[model samples]
Target: MESIYWVLTWACHRRCRHCYEDRFRPYLRADLEAVVAEAERNAPLVLGNLPKRMTYRDPGGPDLPEKMGRVIISGGEALLEAVRERVTYPVIEGLVARYRDTGGVKVVLQTTGDLLTPAIVREVAQRGVWMISVAGIDDFHVGMEGEAKRPPSRRRSRQ
Candidate 1:
């Protein structure tokens, strides 16, 4: 397979009008070790098949295909307060440690951006996350209240 989409948890804070995860199987808790083991098992296979190196369209940029296919870690708000430390970070750390030396294995994080604090962002980036894709600013998602009235500024996490 070119990539793996690992849904780390089924727990989300929002009851979005358009989200279907709650309507489906609603087992919100994730099995951290199981998910990590599975990713560890499959990562080598995926990484092995990719080219060792490839030229990028932008010569000044990093290499392609060899550094491109994503192992996207997402969920019912993957970074939800409940499971961020318990499931999400462990999963990311495990996979990054497993594939740090392997080419073409970028660890990508997908979150709703609701609970992403500066500390969490830094922790993930330091742990080897190549990218963080936030899916928060949509009309369907009910906005937060009071202290969390606004999603954390993405710029705050910039290195």
Candidate 2:
């Protein structure tokens, strides 16, 4: 079973000083059909893509394998409040359901864990998603975003 990490968007609510350039942008909706098509064709262990906000390119051009090993969903902050307010959760849920139906791919949710709440976690778990929190230790602020603006404590957690 191979794995592929997909970057869904760059838009986020919190303005972390250490945030990456890609984080400050609008969300771009990829062509899910194309992405799935490609995945079915390529049994990649690890796959990642830029967020919808980062590019206008159509991702609905390839055919993916039906039995992918794993699928990772990521974004500027996978659990960003704004994203959740918008449509991140629904999209994630839909994808998870589709993948699970195949009984071949395991969905992994990559998040910062900042905006994530107990309810959200429970919902994700119910959908059979494996949550993976990404965070940085020591100078976490510096690593998150290059520019140092506010106090380290005020800055968003690296995760």
By lDDT, the best candidate is 1
**How many clashing pairs per prediction, in order?**
0, 25
**Clashing pairs in model 1, backbone N/Cα/C closer than 3 A:** none
Best by TM-score: 1
- Return the TM-score for each candidate structure: 0.62, 0.51
User: How far off is residue 87 in model 1, in Å?
Assistant: 1.0
Question: lDDT of model 1 at residue 115?
Answer: 73
The 0-to-1 C-alpha lDDT of every candidate, in the order given, reads 0.63, 0.52
Provide the lDDT at 94 for model 2.
56
